[model samples]
Target: MHPQPESGTGTTAGLPATADGRTSSAPPSGPAPAGAPDDGRMTWYVYLAIVISTFGGLIFGYDTGVAGGAAGFVADDYGLSSFMEGVVVSTSLFGGMVGAMAGGPLGDRYGRRPVLLLSGLLFTAGALISAFAPGLAVLLAARVVLGAGVGAASVLVPVYIAELAPARIRGALVSGYQLLTTLGIVLAYGVNALFGAGQAWRWSLGLAAVPGLLLAGGVLLVPESPRWLVSRGRLEAARDLLRRVRGRHDVEAELHEIRAVHRQEARAGSGGWRELNASWVRPMVLVGVLVAFFANGCGINLVIYFAPQILQSAGMGSSSSLLATVGLGAVNVVFTVVGMALVDRVGRKPLLLAGAVGMTVTLGALAVVVSVPGLPGANWLSFACLSLYIVMYAVSPGLVAYVVISEIFPLHVRAKATGVATFVIFATNLVIGLTSLPMLDRLGTATTFCLFTAVCVLFVLFCLRMPETKGRTLEELEARFRAAADSRAHARVSRGV
Candidate 1:
């Protein structure tokens, strides 16, 4: 049913496919051959798309991080109880969960670009409402509105980059979303420190509007995802966009590869939720969901949203705690750069395994340091441990999780599948955000961190089961996963499970 490509064309020779759909050989790197036109590396338009779309990430980071410091002032301003504080802080994540669930179907139906543009508008409106909200209820409503944009951007931005980037630099390019997220968080921390003492949480919460407006306006200038265009049977449009992004490369071969895979899926009736019931589809979706869930379950958001509170508990003053949070933000941004640099060369799995081990050790150490009473330099020790934890997280799971989730699914269901995975992420985030303050108040800091440490240990085991996706084309990765999924299904039938 699928159209065949011309012989000796389409896919390159070195990256061979196995009986299972995975690529058997490593993808080629660096410049193209001597006779080739350009290296097919990044072009101006590609850079533009990446920069513009990732502003959504900036909004994601700012809105999420601003709440950390803003929550204290908000509590003061509204006389919020601990329970109410948690409610206010977590309402956005609930909205994010809703947005993520909707993003996939909407993005798949319309396109990645329109969904992104809509996210920017939602983000802008939410920020303004949050900044100007007169009461706790209004603030909560505004947070939910803002959160929807964050959730949609979370699913759509990485998918956009992954779909657009050339295979050679795809890992690095996709990681840009995470990198910008950290940068936005760092910006929020700086803003929080500047305003923490002045009853200026309104400024901190509302500053997100600037980036939201920028993103909303900027996305209009970029092209839509070539893959999305092809999926809609807009062959010429897909070709033109691919040429713009990829430049002098052989567009026909790439187009054929995309079309061939899409055609195969079409014949197999593989779209929407019903197709997910197929045995092969289930594993990929499961892996994506687990990866998204565990990324949050490891208690990253606990530190992210409650770093100031965590420091305050460790005997630091409000000013000192806000300053310490800035340090944590700095560490996050710096090590995220480390992740961006190494992801393409060192691969995704190793980084994840390393980060998990490092987080377990750091969180356990932080718990012990904080739990001991009257210990010398305990506050500073906690800061050090927290910084190290941020480094470990930023360098590994923080970045790789987004990249892997974006890369693992087949193209046809990618938007829907990513939406599902992102929903799991936000759901986990909502639970953590809501429970973090209460957990600290009721269970104590040491016990709370020990719980997170345990989750990191579980994550290490999860990483062992994940496939490596670096240095491969989207088409190759899709085939490999399908093959592996089929093989597992056959084995399951053999066992009568």
Candidate 2:
């Protein structure tokens, strides 16, 4: 049987103790304030917080997608070779790698809110600098800075939403981040088309600042993650915020559960690289890192960052390629919506398994179609395959990666673990972004796609080791892992190993 959390009593910390003995400094219990709706569907503040946090996702999507289209124009204007183009496009991902590494520790130490605010500022600054950069060096520098913000947001936004949302709808709410990301990609495609004629890639690059600035301001109105507050021993603050977001729900029971988990974590050790040595944490972190690594290894970035280039190679004109990219973006958004609706209802593992199967099939077909000489309508066939690939990806790894990483780790180590995983993701992305153009030039498109197809086949094997995480509370999931770890340790001791 799972262990139940012990009830908290009088405060041991500096904060005032609640009636239950947990530390608290909130005002006495009261009814919902006037003008704050009490209908229990979810307060306006909850919805507002979600909307504000997801702007970061929107910024993430725009910055990443803009590069795919902007690179062509920038290459034309600057007279760039394949290597130089790779540097320009991959620079932001390098920044993202740094951001993901740093954002985790900072978010864990400070709070999710402050880190998000800083990310927004960085996003704004980076966008403006990129838009007006006079030389390739300046553009690369600007993109790195902008990429840092995207990286930070990628790590933080999903965690923030996961913490705030109720378990019942957590999948749907977390997928909102992915949804906004798709919207941002769609917007970038439209912007790319608008400026493609004039080679005004600057406008395409610069426009990301608009959402960046809005996110910076909008986050100011949202509350900090209650879980973060609770971890810091700000019990009253956590309780008050929980009540506000959870409406008429019993905040006390949830608070007690969190308190029990935190106490358990404290006994385990303050979470860090050291704590990760524990058998329980190792499996979770390993899975998280593998998921992040393989998500990129599947070559989604190849599609998003170089769709136009790929299409052009398949005998399409520049205009036709750009239009097809726009179509790809549309398919991404539509299918992502479908995934979001099903995430909560159908569960996470099924979607992941299904997506793996679909991608493997489509990517394999793409390789064959491209490799075969003189195949009729091969270009259109490749296009159809690419579209289907996005559909499969959107349903599974694309949406599931963010949701799973945020959900799997213990609360104490969440930020740090997520940071490590996201760092792996962007680092992998950086390698892919840098090498894709050169690989295409050297290895040819068919061979390159076959390599990606192989990765998908490997990913299917990886999914077999993954645990289904749908519908379980964060506390429950953590306990389950802890129990398994304990069992393994006991068996080892019995064997005198």
Candidate 3:
């Protein structure tokens, strides 16, 4: 019989099976099949690593969505003003800026595992502090700490999965992070509904600490990223890891390719923000920033952070609104899974286009419904449109943006460029969190959603310019962009002539 693996977790506790179909917990002692072909089935090792890493996304989803539900109770207890509410909501994004910037260097210098470990510790520290926070200031500080964890996790986890995975299933594997993020959001909503009514937002906030702790501990079981090892010139270590993960027949060949890529990158000069100003770099950066803006802009943050408040304004009780938000989270998770399943098959750009179209339709209908006064079941109609909006986003940009960040930039500059992109995302989110309520109060629901609808239109246009990066290797992608930049420079010189 095949060796029995450990219980609960899918991986075996002893040595993993050899490529020759033999099993052992002992390290490889022979020339392994490092370059051998795979069976093409999702390996147990790969899937488990993804499952564990996605917990980082869970923390992100929970922290972001939980605030919207819990903040209302916080406001009631402390009698917060619009400014104070915005401050409270925007704290995480502010910290996320630091985390996003920090993530790249940390991942590059320390490898994916250590940085992930740091993220988990930050998450635990942030969550515990927030749970017992006695004042608005304390809570905001705690949220900042937590945001750092989210920002780092957001960048690193997908990169980890992307680097470890083969091209055939990379899209789906990376998308696991997005799907889990949705689950985290949905679970947050459920937790809020279960605990928010009795002034139990503290419990809701504290609960996130559990997953953070688990992530911190669970990361030890996963392997260090081979690409990260290759970058550091640790060829022997990288080879060992690849052999174990991919099995023996493919190790030497994979290492040869990885080393060649690293040498090429080294010769290309170290990548920097200056590259982003180059012609091809300019368009890709624009694509990342605008996609991020629409992803968080367009009032999605407003809806998430203030959904319960909006429901209460529409005439539901606070508790009832919290429960309704839970329903919305459920829908969000389901559609996100659908999006994950489709990403590899459908490609990134098409899903984004579909999501943009869906956002346009749903948000437009929402504006109309919220505008009508006491028109039979207007509140329900508005709620339905809101749910629809989430459904569209969950399957499209919600998942796609993360994939783009994972695969778009060259490997050499990937960490830094993605950090910049993430900073833009959180910065835009901060603006949304700070101003969304005032926008809603001053502009009314109709005008507010109309603004989002306009953003959706812009998102559609911007997405059309995004390259289809599916099924492409990181080396191929980098070469394409570099060549494109070179061609543009030649054109400019010709024009000057």
The number of the candidate with the highest TM-score is 2
Positional deviation of residue 210's Cα in model 3 after best superposition, in angstroms = 0.9
In order, the Cα lDDT scores of the candidates are 0.86, 0.85, 0.79
* Residue lDDT tens for model 1, 182-263: 9999999999999877879999988999999989999999999998887886666777787788876466667667767787
TM-score for each predicted model, relative to the true structure: 0.91, 0.92, 0.89
Candidate 2's TM-score reads 0.92
Worst lDDT run of 10 residues, candidate 3, spans 1-10
Candidate 1 TM-score to native: 0.91
Quick one: ranking by TM-score, best first?
Answer: 2, 1, 3
Which regions in candidate 1 have their CA more than 4 angstroms from the true location?
A: 1-40, 489-497
lDDT of model 2 at residue 150?
Answer: 84
For residues 140-214, write the lDDT of model 2, one tens digit per residue: 999999989988888899899888887877888898898898889989998999899999999999999998998
- Report the lDDT tens digits of candidate 3 across residue range 1-497: 11222223333322255555443324334443354333334567777788889899899888888887777778888999876778877888898899998997788778898889889999999999999998878998999999999889887898898888877678888988888788888889888888865878889888889878877887998988888776775555666777677754355655555555556666565656575665656666767777777887766777888888777666667677778888888888888889888998999999999999899999899888888888777767768888999999989988888888887776666777778888888998998888888888898878888998999998888777778888776666667877888888899899995
Q: List the candidate 2 regions with Cα displacement exceeding 4 Å.
A: 1-41
Q: Which has the better TM-score: candidate 1, or candidate 2?
A: 2
